[model samples]
Target chain A: MSDLSRLSLNQATIKYAGMEQAVSACLRAEIPGIGLWREPVAEYGLRKTGALLRQAGLTPTSMCRGGFFTSPDSDQRIKDLADNRAAVDECAELGVPELVLVSGGLPDGSRDVDGARSMVLDSLAELAPYAGERGVRLAIEPLHPMFCSDRCVVATLGQALDLASRFPAEQVGVVVDTYHIWWDPTVYQAIERAEGRISAFQVCDWITPLPAGVLLGRGMMGDGCIELRRMREAVDKAGYTGPIEVEIFNQEIWDADAMEIAELTAARYVEHVL
Target chain B: MSDLSRLSLNQATIKYAGMEQAVSACLRAEIPGIGLWREPVAEYGLRKTGALLRQAGLTPTSMCRGGFFTSPDSDQRIKDLADNRAAVDECAELGVPELVLVSGGLPDGSRDVDGARSMVLDSLAELAPYAGERGVRLAIEPLHPMFCSDRCVVATLGQALDLASRFPAEQVGVVVDTYHIWWDPTVYQAIERAEGRISAFQVCDWITPLPAGVLLGRGMMGDGCIELRRMREAVDKAGYTGPIEVEIFNQEIWDADAMEIAELTAARYVEHVL
Candidate 1:
């Protein structure tokens, strides 16, 4: 069997599950790691959630997010920075070393993508030091280009690596989520270039006929045409010995039982992504 | 008034119009050129369509497409090649110098994108010589990465240029469509590198919350956030003094009056893309 110890169930994959339930599901499936999200940790109370994971012997793989620093509103921008710092503090409390950063999209009524990108970099310069001081690495996640307008402007692995390379590798890293970067022709080369900067290696499949909002269309492992095992192997070759988190966001997957989803995900990971 | 002499109205912008009607509409709107599609040319009878275009003093800017060589079935591959050759023949008959090529997506149940990409190259090697002999330049159009799986595997201008460089620039070139490539970080640089091999320059806008199938979601020139003028300037700076074809694919656009649509497109081309 593939190493179950290295498998992580990102809470988003089982969207309906509470933080407590997600930890229990991971425990029941013998999944040694659980990737936490900021909202759920806050909902369950950070200390209680951290204690729950500790009690279950489950490692907190990484925190879900902490970026969105491209708001056009000055007040919102300040709020976003403050929120990100809080995320870093949460990571410290949860003992999670990595915090995924989703750089926000272009500002409302604005076509200046370069400006938005610069804002992300500027925010990172401020936050990276804070995150590093708390032993939390900021993992810049290059979301799919389709999400460039409203979700995240960092659209390619190369761009993410270029930004991450600007900071110390430990302070600023990248999340290689296959759903977003699999379409990139230079992805393998980018992976090779991202040696020590790879903070989290997330896997999900890419099935098309993308649904309306295009947000909840990710396929389950082996349910789509992504060469999952190949991507995992590339990250491994890049010297990343980190947890491989399954992070699907489909509505159908969310409606299912959390433990069943976790068990099936583990099985699929072994079958198709080992 | 911005230059109208170099404008071409691709029939897709007025999707409901028949070939003859599209030609007449372009002529009425004083649109000097048009980009033809194979199906409509075949429907109107290729020779008749060619005669009609010549009679109306309308130039055939480029042929719509001729690729899709990534099918897994051997018979389908043979058929695709044969169809592409016929498209080349049609281009020759119509006196169109360029044929836009959209390389097919992955074969069903296949996860090897590299293998699929190689198939496109091999097919190009075979077809390039045939197209060259007929004086028809094969313009490889790298679609948006969202279409990388189901529609076309060539998903970036750089990748298209890489493939185009392998063949004689006269025989193989690349299409710079703003809607498909605007998200790319290196698009302007790629356009400059395209220099002598830019066969066609197409424009459309990029609006979000893409409709089902995402095929007909392309916005009319000024309806979305793309820096249309900037992209056009980049193409011009790259030394391409050719027809600027407006190729939008949207349901509402298709349902509008073709002549009105053509007139508005011309106006928008001047206001936004010129």
Candidate 2:
């Protein structure tokens, strides 16, 4: 039998369920880990969510996300920095290992992507030290390029690593999610370069002939063509022994029974990834 | 009046029109440049199409495409390389400055994007010498990440440049199409780094609240929220003085009259960009 202990279920995999229900479902399935999002945590209250997960004997894998550093105005940027500091505080309070970050996209009313990226770096520099002191490692999640306009400025593993390399490894690192970066040519090299600084490793399949322009077309394991074993091998080779988080966002799966989705994800992790 | 001399029309913008019809429309409108595709040229016969464009004073800006380097087997890769060499010959014969390359996506039954990229690089190395001998520059077009699985492997401008930097500038360059790369955070810096290697600059708008699952949701010039003038300025600052090709692939624009679309594109370029 394969070891299924390394599997983690990101809450987004069954986001339709309330935070309490999700925690119960994870407990029911005996899934080893959970990745929490801010919205649900805020709704249920952080202390309650933390207590629920702890009661379920689940390790919090990583926080859902916390970066959007690009803005057209200086005041807006300062406000975003403040917001990120708050996210860091939340992650620390939740006792999560890392605070996942989706770097902000281009500033509104502007097309200078490079300029916006510099602003992201500046914001990260400001937030990393605060997050470091709080014992919450900043895990930069490089989203797919499709989200580069309105979602995240960090769009590749290499770019994320480049940004992370600027800070101390203990303060800033990267999250390797198969759904966001499986198509990137430099992903393997970037992962290798990331070494032990890979704070999180995520898995989800990419559905072919992508469903229109919806940015969130995440497929469940074995439903799409991602070679999970190979990606896991890459992470292992890079010395990352963190829990493998299942972070799917498929609408069909989300609409299904949350317990069923959580159970299926755990089974898929055992059957496909392990 | 703003100079219309710099405007070029990509055939895909009017995909509904026949090659002869597209050429006739360009001639009627007095547009100076035309980007041709192999399918239409093959359909109408190359000799006749070449003669028609030549007689109409249409300078072929760049060939439609010539790279699909990733495949599941060596035989398929060999076939792709041979086809690309033939495309290089066609571009040379047509006297175009560059042969646009959409480095093909993942090979079937393969999830190793790095391996697929190696295949692409190997194929380019095999084809570049031949392309260089024929005086045709291979322009690597960094398609949107949505196309990364089924369409093209090169998904970001930085990734494309990193690959291109492996070869001589004359042998490998890039096609900066706004539709494919407007969302990249490092797009401007990547373009600036590309500098003398920016062979072609293409334009298209991005529509938000995109339709479901169809990843190729291209917007027309003024229909979406892309900062066209800013993109133009970026390309200009990169020192590319080539034709500013309007290369929209929107269903709405394609369903319109070809002549009307061309006229509208020209008008938009003048009003928004000039």
- Candidate with top DockQ is 1
Among all windows of 10 consecutive residues in model 1 chain B, the one with the lowest summed lDDT is B208-217
Model 1: share of native contacts present? 0.49
Model 2 docking grade: medium
lDDT of 1 by residue, B180-264 (tens): 9988888888999999999999999889888877888899888887888999999999999999999999999898999999999
Q: What pairs collide in candidate 1?
A: none
List the DockQ of the predictions in order.
Answer: 0.71, 0.49
lDDT score, candidate 2: 0.84
Tell me the tens digit of each residue's lDDT in model 2 across A189-211. Answer: 88899897899999989887565
lDDT of 2 at A246: 91
Candidate 1 residue lDDT tens string, A10-79 = 9999989998889889988889999988888888899999889888999999998899989878898889
| Candidate 2 chain A lDDT trough over 10 residues, lowest sum | A207-216
